[model samples]
Target: MGRGLPGSISGGVKRRGLPGAAKEERIVVLETENAALHLKLAEYQGLAGRSTSEVLQLYSAHGQQQKLQRTSVVTQLHGTVKRLKQDLKRLRSFVLELSKDFQRQSKTYLYQILTAVQGIQLENEAMQMFQIKAFDLEQSLQEVTERYEKEKQKRRALHNSLVELRGNIRVHCRIRPLLPFDAASGHSISEDRQRNFPEKVAYAADDETVLIKCSRPGHASINRTFQFERVYNALESQDIVFADVAPLLTSLLDGYNVCIMAYGQTGSGKTYTMLGPQLEENFAFSIEDESELGIIPRATQEVFRLLSEKPPGSYWVEVSVVEVYNNEIFDLLAKDNYGKVFGVKREVVTTREGKSDVPLLMHETVENAAEFLHLVNKGVQLRVRHPTLVHAHSSRSHLVVTLTINTIISGDNFGTSWEDEQTSQRLNKEVSCTFPQKMRENKSTSSSRASSPTQLEATEKLKKVKTRLQLVDLAGSECVGMSGVTGAALRETSYINRSLSALADVLGAIAEQRSHVPYRNSKLTHLLQDSLGGDAKLLVMLCISPDQKYLTESMQTLGFGTRARQVQRGQLKKKNFPVPSKAK
Candidate 1:
């Protein structure tokens, strides 16, 4: 019975084992299916990756083809640009040739017309003078007999007395003190008290005055004294000077040479008055407004304003700025090494009228105040400067800026019909009568005369018109002891004093009406000879300090002013001297 039970239990165990084995086999088959799926998925993924790579390669090949096409287009464009550049070069050459040809033809026509007109005009004038003289003689002969008997008796009764007289009318301008910046407060201190005040506590009248005071700490005390004569307040004084000189400037537009100069002692606001006190705020001043206009800027504005009012092509204005350093002339507009000093030689050209002093041309065009200031600032940078006990940034030399005005009157008749017709008829009749048909008919004779080098040159000379206007700023005359100058400054001081003394001598001689005034004694006097004693309308600004400390110097300055006032060049009129064409 135990054996039979064991066999049945074993069979039962076998049966359980068989089901477990079948479950394991099913698990294995599922596992095998999972592996097969994974392998198929891997194979599919590999094929997809290959397809993507092929597509990427095709895209890359397309990009390369596009790049090649773009390169070809760029190359063609470069070639076209090169050809266009060549064409532009040719066009420039052609334009230059055309300009040269136009200039030459214009000059030739001008010369021919001028020669014919001048000759006829001269002959007509001579004939008119002759006829007038002949008529006057005829009238005189008729009256001679009647007056001869009465004149004899009157001459016998006349008493013999010789009287010679000379006199001059001196025009002086006493510019009133400008309104104080703080006039609203009315708490201004006396000049004496202001001088004694502490450095920082010292009150300045305006922004520019404050900048000037700060620029040279030591000179502030002395500068405060001169407030009455020449105010450091650029906001006030510069505009006033422009107003004062407006009349003289107006005459400049009428073909007259005008010179405006600033003369004073060192540290006496010469630079401040002429160039304005150095301050960034001063640039805010505009040329359009008189309240903000400076000397140079205002002058340029006035000139252009007048130019605009004049008939077009009737006038042209050119500007040049030059500096005189150590009695030597230097062209401020010249180009040179960044820091090197470049100078130009002055040439004395002899003209038909007389010997003329012609400075080297440094032509510049100034359209506005800002442009003018830029050129002036560039010039200021190039100007010689040094530190001194009196002024931290003292001007080492004098600077002069000249504006040359050239005006041409086109002989083209712009007058009314009556005047034009009259002139035309008169000109035609005069031309025919003076030349005679015989002369006109002889082509060889006319050609020979026209082709003559001297005649052609003279004819060319008379065709154009030119005028000059000069604005000069003289260096301040300084005393060594007052300036506390030494070494190089001492030498400069000596040159300055000597030149100023020479200037004083020239003024004295002019006052005395000496026939032989020594103008060549110094370069300053020589350069200013025409403006001082010649036809130029001169305005001498006698800068003085009101402080008691400068009383003696102020007195001397006033005395100089008095002497300057005594000098006169008579009732001088503008003289348009004939210039040789080749002089330039």
Candidate 2:
């Protein structure tokens, strides 16, 4: 049994070894097949239809991949086509509606355009009618303007006649614009107050009224209004002023004594209104500044121009310049012992004939306006002027410029000169000795002309008509505190105030019809006796500043002007007298 077991074990070992050999043989066969596949890869270059390439690829068929992809692509293309057809259908509908809207809107706009055209045509026709009406209105306005101008002239004439009959002094107010020195005129102006208040405080309310507006911070506002015969605003030129004053010159030429005086506060343009901005001592009247010429220079020129139209030497004009300083009259044309012209103090005396005269007053006969202005310039050099808080070239004295016109008439063809004075007292006395005798002469002189050449040639009687034109520039009223004057200027202020007060008192007396008109109260009143009391046409010019600093002074000036306008001195008696001509 042992022997048989050994032989079986050997047989089992042989069987196992034989199985191992068979497995090795199968692996060798697989490696050879792989090598052959590698050779096929080298021949085809790892891809089909690549003869020179060496490659090997192994592909497997899917279930339906290409068919599924193509199906998806075709489905997407169908979706796109369906969306395009829907979009085209929507676009066609939108286009059709857009065309209909365009047509509808075009019709609407065309209708509106036609309606606008019709409306424009109607407006054109209406405009033509309106233009015709406007033309008619313009023509009517032109006619009315012409009529108004004519009525204005007639009204002016009638007004003058009424004034002449009533014998009321005409007052004109002039409101000057605010000036720099106006603040200096008043010491009350402070920096804070100046900032609080506006500059212009006074103005012209109308052609005949002056209004003062006193508005201040934390103060009761006050407003004052005044009326006068005429009111000139700041915008008015000196020419406009002269135009109104030229009529007085006509009265002067017609044998009427006329006095034109300027009254106002210091730095209120009184001097500028009278003597002009050329009040300087060395001022030369230039034609370039012709528009700036004030009343005095312009009057001088106008008088000469009027005289030029008269017959040669028919009238001789003698001009005299006088200045009142410290209540004393000084002849500015007076000659000293050295033949040098200086202001010679003169006495103003009331004559027995109720007329005022200045003895030894130098009157220079001027042939033309040039000579007259030249003499005035000389007098201005001698006139007293000092720097004040108000005005830099303030006039400290009153200036009186008198033009004495002598109407010389003799034979019908011949002329006579003023060479004969029967006595030295003739210069001091009027032509007539008494008022009643003057009235008789006034009545008889007119009838005497009818008796004419027969009676005139038999006696060889010559007549001379004398008239006086007095233009006065009064010294401005000033307050000592406001002017800050000292020494001589203080004295001047005192005199000036007193004299102005006296003038106001005289006007009050006249306005009240007092029997005793205080004409002799001051030299100013005494000098202006004829103009104030006697039969003479007097015009008062009230000048005012538009500054609040001068409000008080402006009110006072306006008050004075108001009182002056109320004085009715009886009908103006014509000063027509035939003085016996000097027998040559």
Candidate 3:
């Protein structure tokens, strides 16, 4: 039964299996389609992942390029901004400088405009006043001219008289105050006058006399009165002494040779009188006290002042300084820094015109007193000085300063309208060669012969005047023992004494009126031959000390001065060029 049932079921199942098989086939097809879709989805998923990676890489590169471009643009903008800021700074600096320049220019223009306006207003006012005062000014000028003419005549006459009377060789005596060293050694010089004049052995009697009293062993008080041209007491100041010397400088300007010399014993005041104490160290004429200036400085100042009183360029002043040490001539101006004098020994030569001059001597041209003082100071610095027991600073040589003055006068109408007898003689001699000139109408008459007015006027322009001034500071005479000198100093002392003795001998010969004066005995005398013999005006300043120890030396100096005063020379005449007439 089971087999029959299985077959029937199988037959029925076949009918149902056909449908079931078709259902299975449909299910398999559906599974196959699903598998194919899965495969395609896997392929699509791999492609999508690779494409996503590539897209991500391309987006990163694009972002990098955009960043680079933006960076470049920003850098350019920054550079442009920086250049603009620099240009702005330059423009601001230029504007500031232009503003400053404009401010300065405006201030200057304002000042100039104000000044011009004020000047124009003042000129208009001055023009109105000028016309009103013209007549009064003319009258005043006429009155001044008349007064000037009268004063001119008087000045000319006074100048002539001074020239005549001031020609004598005068001797003056000056006594210095007692020094500290001299006071320390207080010895009774006079037993009688110890109470009143303890150290005053020599006393000034008057303006021209000095009384000296000395105690002798046997004889009663030896009283002697020495007469000089002038005597100054110890209390007298330097200015008072220079008052007597100032007129000599004026005589020099009038064309006369003037020589002023100082002579004294050692430790007296020779250098102080000639040149102030240590003035070379100061090197200035503008001293705190003008009265302290010595004769040389005073004379130089007066010379410059007088030169300024006249026209400029009318005179030329030249100065030279020389020193004589141990009978040797040395140019103090010609020296090196080491105090060694340069060049060969200068010889005093007498020119054909009978004038004495040292050849090759250095002459420095000086304009004012300051320049002259500087030059003189330079020469003084080169001078030899030695400290001695008698004087702390003693000049070891004779210093001579010479001033040569050359003057040019345009015409005879310069200050003087009339001609004197000497002028007429000089003019006549000069004009005789060039123009036909006759002698004076009368030989006895001092009046000049009147030449043709035209010829007289023509010759007036050829006048020139020259004069020489010498300032000599002689070495102080010293006693060898008192000066505490030996060796080379002793030899120098001997030469100095010898030269002084020769000078005294020359003066003695002149006083005795000898035919041949012993001027060639020493270089000093030989150099002073012109000043001693001719019409050269000479002045001797005898400086003495009030110290009792120098009584003997002072007496000797007085005696020497007395002998010098006896020397007589010809009348001094002004040196001037002869008027030249028109050449034929």
lDDT of every model, 2 decimals: 0.54, 0.76, 0.73
The residue-by-residue lDDT of candidate 2 on 259-357, one tens digit each, is: 999999988888788877762446433435888888988888877776665544345677888988899989898888998888889989988898888
Error of 1 at 21 (Å): 99
Clashes of 2: 6
lDDT of 1 by residue, 235-341 (tens): 34566666656756666654446766666655555565556545433322233444544466677667666556543333334455566666665666665567443
Candidate number with the higher lDDT (1 or 2)? 2
lDDT of 3 at 479: 78
Best by lDDT: 2
State the lDDT of candidate 3 residue by residue for 23-79, as single tens digits.
566555655666677789889999999999999998998999999999999999999
CA error at residue 224 for candidate 3, angstroms: 0.8
What are the runs in model 2 whose C-alpha is more than 4 Å off? 1-98, 120-152, 182-197, 217-221, 279-287, 411-460, 577-584
**Candidate ranking (lDDT, best to worst):** 2, 3, 1
TM-score of each: 0.50, 0.72, 0.59
Decoy 3 TM-score against native: 0.59
